[model samples]
Target: MLYFEDLTPGRRFETASHTLTQDEIISFARQFDPQPFHTDPEAAKTSVFDGLAASGWHTSSLTMRLITASELKNVANGLIGMGIKDMRWPQPTRVGDTLRATIEVLAQKASGSKPGFGVVQLRWTTLNQHDEIAMQLETSIWVARRPTEQA
Candidate 1:
């Protein structure tokens, strides 16, 4: 598992891609979002998206899934998030769009109150097959510090 000491600023990790299918987008929207543009293809044709679009939340959820399934998830057995900041969805994710995610370490600092742990600042970027950014966010994660070894 990666400890706080191992995560340096500018370090980057990327995950395998997942294609967003119409069925998947519709199903997710039906359950959680239910916006016509996200749930009904015919209705979406006239929406600003001009086609069925995946909900921003669905895109975020898929990004989380990709990150957790990647090797980077080995950090401290799991990434313990402190909070998210500056989340933006710049473009609509459409059906059959293959999505990939990248995580970049922005900074790290020892926790003032939680000794043996640190808060790591990270930037997450999600892009579609055309390399268009679909979503981006900054977040802080609590990472365990390396344990002191016996002398």
Candidate 2:
């Protein structure tokens, strides 16, 4: 299993490409986030975004997959979520735009209060096949560290 020691600051990890489907987008939006831009394409066209766009939550969920496939799950410290900080959807993700995620480790600090755990801050950026950035996220997660005995 991967451990906290395995995470290197400034390191980056990427995920396989995936295309967002219109049906899937509508499905998710209909349930969790029902907004004009997310649920109705014609309304979205008249709205500012031009067409149907995925919710930020949906984008976040996709980002998690990239992290999981990157083996972050194995390295997490009980998988504690610290919440997102800055998030921006620069470009609307269309149904056919192939999407990929990349994560860059920004910081790693052993928690002073939580023994045997470390806090990791990362920037997760999602891009399309054309190399255009679609979403930007700042995520903070806890990672289990090697016990003192092992260290």
- Number of the top TM-score candidate: 1
What is the per-residue lDDT of model 2 for residues 1-151, given as tens digits with 9 covering 90 to 100? 6566776799887778778899988898999999989999889888778788888778777767766776556664555678888898888887887888888889889889977788888898999889998889898888888765644
Task: Give lDDT per model, in order.
Answer: 0.95, 0.81
The parts of candidate 2 lying over 4 Å away from their true place are 76-78, 148-151
The clash numbers for all candidates, in the given order, read 0, 2
TM-score of each: 0.97, 0.89
Output the lDDT of residue 95, model 2.
80
> For model 1, which pairs clash?
none
lDDT for predicted candidate 2 compared with the true structure: 0.81
Tens digits of lDDT, candidate 1, 27-96: 9999999999999999999999999999999999999999999877789847988899999999999999
For the record, the alpha-carbon RMSD of candidate 1 to the native fold, in angstroms, is 0.8
